[model samples]
Target: MINTHTNAQDLSSWQQKYPGVSEITTDYSEHYQISINKNNQLVITQDNYEESMIITDKGTGFSAVESIVFSDLFRIKSYEAYTLNNVNGRQKKTEVAHIADKKLDRQSVFDSDVKLKTFNFANLTTGSKKVLKYEMEFIDPFLLHRFMFATSAVNEKRTLKISYPETVKIDYKLFNIDKNNLEIQTETKKGITTITFQKQNPVVVKQDSEAAGIMYEAPHLHFWISEYQTKNQTHPVLGSIDKLYAYYHTFISKINQTENQELKNFTLDLIKDCKTNEEKVKTIFKWVQKNIKYVAFESGYEGFIPREAALVYERKFGDCKDMASIITEMAKYANVPNVNFTWIGTRELPYTYQQLPAPAIDNHMIATYINNNELIYLDATNATVPFGLPSSFIQGKEALIAQGNSYIISLVPEVKSNLNTIHDKIELSLIDKKIVGKGTFDANGLAAAQYRSIIGDNLLKRKDFAFALLEKGNNKFKLIDFKEIDFDNSEKPYSIDYNFELDNYLVNSGNETYLNLTLDKPYQNDSFEPTRSQTFDHEFLQKKSYQVVLEIPSGHSVTYLPESTTFSNDLLAYQFSYSQENSKVYLNYDVEVKQTLIKPKQFALWNESLKKLKENYLETIIIKQHEKN
Candidate 1:
């Protein structure tokens, strides 16, 4: 008989060889069998198996507490877990003792039909292996199927199999499969077709670090029921973009458009004083942004259908769909003719309707008003966003607008870096061992809007917030006195005049003084990791400029000045200059982040730019005392 000690030792040796991996997936398989009964109702039975070995304590213990998520569309058949451990001279197997079932209502602020089934294995420890087996049935055929091979842990073996009757025609697509070594096999026997996908020793992918969506990083498959055949007829489900749009339009059409007299009068009153159409639209848009509180409600049909416009107006709070409905309806009542309902996806998704043609492509709804052939997307969910600008989350994304019986797809423009500017000017003099300065900080465009939002209602905490925003050098830097100008007026740029002092900022040796002139180094350590596999997303472009004028003391003279430097690339640009004239040292620094995305291939160039920026921050200005004659 084989000794169990030797088996454990072999397993331990394999784990030691790959020390970076905390857990290993020994086996993962998903089998889906589909059939249509005599009543023409589609039935899908799924069997799943997941086996993993705990190599280390890092990420292994969490696997013992297994949780399975299911919705109203699925029914659990069976679930079980077994723990295999080496005890004394033989392998011992112990089954899970307890199982828990609970409603997953707290997963989000919205109500949901999803539920969770959880079970904890017994005696989970390092060098132990756990196996989870479960089966479920799909209550609806339209739920489709999605499978992924890559996981957080390194998977040694994975398999996905789908068997269905020939009467049902299913279409499938593979995403990000070319980057991995996955095998596909298909076999047909006696009016039944079977497809299998397998992967061996797949590399672990970190989803959080990826720039693109999960669909772009992991090897996954999306299978949908395209059509089904009966004795002498065929029926079509959702197979094309038109079909998908038709299905979506059904939900939108269900929205009760009955005009409420109170809502219409309220909208009219809000925009009565506006002079132009533009002003009227802005008034209505701002009113919705200020009044409607966004609370998402995604439970079954509520997830797809929007509440009535009048109901939403009365509720004072609604989700994205309700907000969009109220805004669109209010715009009509306000006599804004060009406004339309729009659908879009956030930055987290990398899909286009033309490519995926599914409901998963878009997750948000808004209102768009066109003036002079230019579209202004309004999302009331973001209360802080300005009237004419699209929300930051939907920038550079495609928008689907409702147009009579048809729809128009247009791309939302990306805001440029120069539009979001932060300009600062400061004049200071060294006194004793501290540096005292007074400067004006000016913000424009989105920067100004963001500042106003941050400083809202918290006037008492403005000093602390300003200090956090503008403090430079070291922890000893203190905000002395400050005055905010034009901050309450959103039409003008937000400006703050602040007086500050920095202690222990200057190094003195006898009569010579050394000071590192680089203040407010924003991107000091913003380099991308070398092992990063995905592109980086910055979300928004930004431009910052700083000017500092340092007054020379009564008897001090400039001894050395570092050379001016400039760095520029497609992703970022920087310029630093320094000059001394008439008892004053002037420093000008400007940087522009050109794009919001940094591709993986540009990591090296980006790191090089950051390195130069860091080196420039280390340059020092030397001041020497003048000798008395």
Candidate 2:
């Protein structure tokens, strides 16, 4: 039993104290009790409490909606909600009249047993308090739950308690906890151990513009049952990395790898004309990448189990696990050696299997092929990614490759900035009252792949996409004509040639003409917020080069030229240079970002670099008319 009264008077007092808080959490508590039942099964009982008060006049008459998700592994034992109102120093209570529980189809690709419980409290006026209480019983102790202390509202106090029998061993990890405000206590009695954690005036949850994931900044607890003893028998759960791998192996081992006749024949047909084993493997990989559609289904056991390769072949659609299975089997059929089923986490997750030996550590699956002592990771989810390049989201993440009796952990290599390059070459000249130019844009590596994906097969939208990519200067710039060359050829660089005109780009004041030669400043406004606490994630290394040749008209001569500028640091570098040769004024700009992550501590340096970059963009090239000879 936990405190349910929100105390409307206390909420009013808090309103005066805090001033502008939209809502305040009055009470938030959780208790979990774990024990071994007579049937030798581990059982967990959960008690939860949540209460909040609306403080501001802007928050009055707002509807409150609460939702909870559960599956067959857990059952809700009890649920109740109530509202308290303070009017003229009197307290009035109203119980919730309606609640709805319905099964949710998170994805249409597969069947799921997950359900969502939702209810609404309407007509919540100022100084109103709402409370919700629920209890759940876990049918499977292996499926543990996570508790987060910070939320959208300001939390005044939060308490968590866990009690377990002495015979059962549990492991817990605390993340992002503020040691200055957290309190812990432990007590043992009657062969039972209990641990309590309490915190007051916890930091309110604020969205960090630089954070890659909210979980990286929020305080939370992750605990799991490791081992238990019941009826003179000891059972091991997730006690170590080996045990975790073994448990995951159970799911992978169950996937039938026998290549059916259709799959074998199809794979053989795809590789029959290939010259080498590498080419054969790539042929099969590309076949699957272009054919199979990815449909993820994460409900109960369906999340871990991979459908048979033959079944997936028939359906032509499956989740990441299913895709991995089909690709692995197909490669084996093609006589490709060292084909491995690998588990990896995307950029959204910050944990590794060694740190947290649980399913939460990894959320994606791919096939790794070892050829000539080199590893080639393949993911069929993105049809645009070329061979030998890992998906951008999994770069630098750990890969848990499944071996026959053991597993190997390897780090995925990060793609170099030089490999993904964007080069722009333009020649500009003043025509009439507008600046007109003919330019060519070239992209290679991941840049090319990304452009191809964005352009897709819609022939009508290619010009529009090219215009959007080449947009520069101001809104008055327009694309007059464009042509895409080698865009469809993946082996070659994606190139686009376009001629554009900018209206009123050259301002004529008396004898001087002004032009801002900086066509595009991509990172001019990329400064991070000063108060951000989490590291910002950069998707990939990038290198950009721009060269502009301004052909001086017969009657014009350069009078004032912006000085060259260069900025460099370990993380990033930029160079802008201007020169004149005979009748051509050449401008070259180059930028390179060497790292894929910008830490919070590096924000100051990054901001300073941005400031310099913005200043360079503002420099203008002034030309004077030849005094009308």
Candidate 3:
């Protein structure tokens, strides 16, 4: 049996049981010549820089020590020091040297019962190569949370020196490094630093150190590191996979022994009420959604599968995994067709289930499928989301569908992008040097789902929110009324009307106040900045309609009016019109996007249209205040 314990004595005993294991011995010392400059990039090097060294050793079968030695050239965001004691929740600690001498209280960040503790700085010499050393008495038994040793001294170069006893194998994974500016020279057979510069700024640094034991009998151990510049060079600590698994097993065992039986029975019985499979499926979905709330619990093992289906059902609340498990069970009992449990990430990801070996491909979710074909991704935490459309986040992702023991099916979906759509009408009056107008705005299709997901079930509040959004501009404004807001679970489109008053939305110092007729809708902007520097490629099914009737103040003449503009691209379609007669100006605008994906080649064109529309909105209305007297 595998023994998973973090206690020194427990680990010591376990190590003695395994013979022929490679003794763990590591000596890692690195130097840095660091200084801050204008670009805010850390410049570090070994020969002329500050230095640090750490020596860690562990006999065969025992977790090995991790140590560090350093000089003060490292300008860290924050410093936290720890000295081990036999207190209630205290873990290990290092001998204090450069910073203040103190022991740190240890508990996971998400541990509500634990007091929050912080360290401001560390003890070390301020000059180059001023060595400070810290030794780990024993191999750390527990997994360290997200804490990685890192520093970002503006405009400095950096280097690392690591030495192992040639007993343990090592592997390093690097991400977000500028390959053009980096070079590596090492004695170890397979120790190398990798770099990726996808985006233009703030290079991301990542490294993974792993030790492989004998094949199936022994588990592989690894230490992961990631560094980036934060306000104070601070990073959150997350535990390792082995430690997490152990913590999860312990928690699940405890939770299983105690759960709500009535809630379980209620959920089980709820499935029975469905007259048909479809109804049963829908009903079960509704039950889970109404009962379970989405709460992320990534502290230690809390990130794993929940305690039990019965307990989660009784509580009516759980993380994504918990809710998914419960729904899976209910679906099984109700005979709502054949369904499998699966994993999925939100929409921002481009990974597929076929890439299951990529451990970090997904973080949350469980997909329910019918006869191993049609699929419905469910997220119980999003209580207000309608059936069919998973929250926009998980719209396109890979899902690990359970098939049988050691057999899981990988599922991926075609991208389901939200289309741009806006319908609006405005009534306007020219007053003094400004133009006052009231208008109504509406939405449909994926655009409606996006709004509903955010607004939830509070229809009145949702309407008020829309009105408030439309009230923004360079002028003082107010929304007096709204109408025709409705949601249809069965229909592909949902609609809403928002009414409001605008003041000085557009103006000039002259005799005329010009108003641009392009309507700004909620779906106009996509919030993703890709690293590859590629332009947006997804096409949007977009539509915009607006009608504005301007009541010009008596004796005021129109100076300049914008000619109607219209255009269409592989990814978009648009039209606009303006007319003047007597004391009223009539303006109508319509925009519709016909595609779902936009290629990089078309991004420049899309940007041009967007710029033109924004310019139209910025065009001011110039009204002569009293006709210049």
TM-score of each: 0.90, 0.93, 0.57
Better of 1 and 3 by TM-score: 1
* Candidate structures ordered by TM-score, highest first: 2, 1, 3
Best by TM-score: 2
Q: Where is the poorest 10-residue window by lDDT in model 3?
A: 211-220
Question: Any idea how many clashes model 1 has?
Answer: 0
**In what order do the candidates fall by lDDT, top score first?**
2, 1, 3
Query: Quick one: RMSD of model 1?
Result: 3.4
Clash count for each candidate, listed in order shown? 0, 0, 59
Clashes of 3: 59
- Per-residue alpha-carbon lDDT of model 1 for 447-543, expressed as tens digits? 7777787777787898888888889989999898888888766557788899999998899999899988777887787888867776677767789
RMSD of candidates 1 onward, in order = 3.4, 2.5, 16.3
lDDT of 2 by residue, 192-278 (tens): 899988888877677776466767778877788889988778899985778778887888886764549998998888899999988
For model 3, how does the per-residue alpha-carbon lDDT over 1-629 read when each residue is reduced to its tens digit? 11112355533543353333322111122322222235534333332222221111222222112222221221232322332322343433344433432222343222212222222222211110112232221111122111112221111224343333222222333322324534445443443232211211122222211111111111111222222233455332223333223332343344334435565466558866567666677777777776676565553355645647776766667777787767766665565555545556554344443322233445665646564455666666666556654554554355655443323444444333333355666777656545556666666545665666667767658656666556644446666665554554523455545445566566464544555544343234543323223324232245667677778777666666777777776656666677888778777777665554444455566667665555555443344435555
Model 2 earns a TM-score of 0.93
Off by over 4 Å in 3: 1-118, 122-182, 185-276, 347-356, 406-422, 427-439, 444-464, 483-499, 505-513, 519-563, 568-574, 577-609, 615-629
Query: What CA RMSD would candidate 2 show?
Result: 2.5
